[model samples]
Target: MKKRIVSLAMAACLVLSMMVTLSACGGKPTLEEYYNSDAMQTIITAAVSQYEAQGVECSVTASGDELRYDFTIDIQTTEEERAIYAETLESQMPADYQEFIDEAKSIKESVSNETVTVVVTYYDADANVLYTQSYSSDG
Candidate 1:
């Protein structure tokens, strides 16, 4: 009976250790870490400079396994200009980071005469979008 009890305890300890290891491996990237990464910030700065926009702002939020990127650019742009800007933004994404944009689960873009907003969100593992919102000068 004592031998059986000792074996059970050993099993429990093994299970607990496995749980801790899995939790550590499951750690997701934080918004701040993503935003501050040199690769990500460089792409944003490049887009802002290419468009000659006033400024570019970025935010990242996560819920469970979902990750979202919200970018706002201040610029006076017409409908046509907005389209071009969007293209330029995509092009500015670094080769190594293109997967982030390409694999986005949902992409939402909004443009007005004075401001442009782009929100690209995706699941952490598969890059699936949950929600999207976009606007244009025509609307």
Candidate 2:
């Protein structure tokens, strides 16, 4: 009778350990699931509103585990001005660029172990592409 009780206890422990392992592995959401979550939508909406207040049209979209930001300048500019703007974009990023990247990485890590890439594209007033840049979590 004592041997039977010991065997039953051991079996129970094995089952409990398996349950724990499965739960730990399945707790994290996929990239697409997190991207479509309400919390992510709130972040995107706030960002869009802030850019709109500055007279720039902005949008965020998901592209195969990557995030894309598109910003359109509202004011018309001459070719020289556009050239200068493009040069500036290539030289330096906005002050909040790093912050944005950090937040993206943090959120992605929290949801899953997958890495994320962020792409930024700037458009002129006439819808012509002016500049493009990308940031990756791998670095």
Candidate 3:
């Protein structure tokens, strides 16, 4: 069984009733043709740079497009020592883990081998308050 390396945010995705309301006024590049490149270093650098500006610790797991792309991101620490935070979350993340698993199962049910774009960001103070975003091909 592939222990899908789900991102920390994805693992804490318990906001079923809390939906992100984005009023897409149309402008961002289409998922289809936007990230279809092999310049992973460039792409990752950009994402990391943008996030780092906001005082974030980041790591881009993978990158590509319809053919290949990132699937998971591991969150290390927020602002201070990660050891303490990780220890605390490890004990309290069970329920969140279950919810995250359920969410991944749903995504698996709905998605195919379709390449996905994912970015996982953990808040410096709150491990549960992670920012995870996924992008699918331009269908």
RMSD of each: 19.0, 15.8, 13.6
Give the higher-lDDT candidate: 1 or 2: 2
- The TM-score measured for candidate 1 stands at 0.33
lDDT of 1 by residue, 19-117 (tens): 455357664234344334454455444543533444445445533233456555544555566556556655655452544543232111110112222
The deviation in Å at residue 58 for candidate 3 is 12
Between candidates 2 and 3, the TM-score winner:
2
- List TM-scores for all candidates, in order: 0.33, 0.69, 0.30
lDDT of 1 at 53: 47
Tens-digit lDDT string for candidate 2 (1-139): 6744764465445535544554587776555565565656665676687789889999888766677889999867788888999998887777657856875675466556478777889998898778887777764
Model-by-model lDDT, in order?
0.41, 0.71, 0.38
Q: Ten-residue segment with the worst summed lDDT in candidate 1?
A: 105-114
Q: In candidate 3, residue 18 scores what lDDT?
A: 18
lDDT of 3: 0.38
Q: Which ten residues in a row have the lowest lDDT in candidate 3?
A: 14-23
Top candidate on lDDT is: 2
Q: In model 2, state the lDDT of residue 14.
A: 50
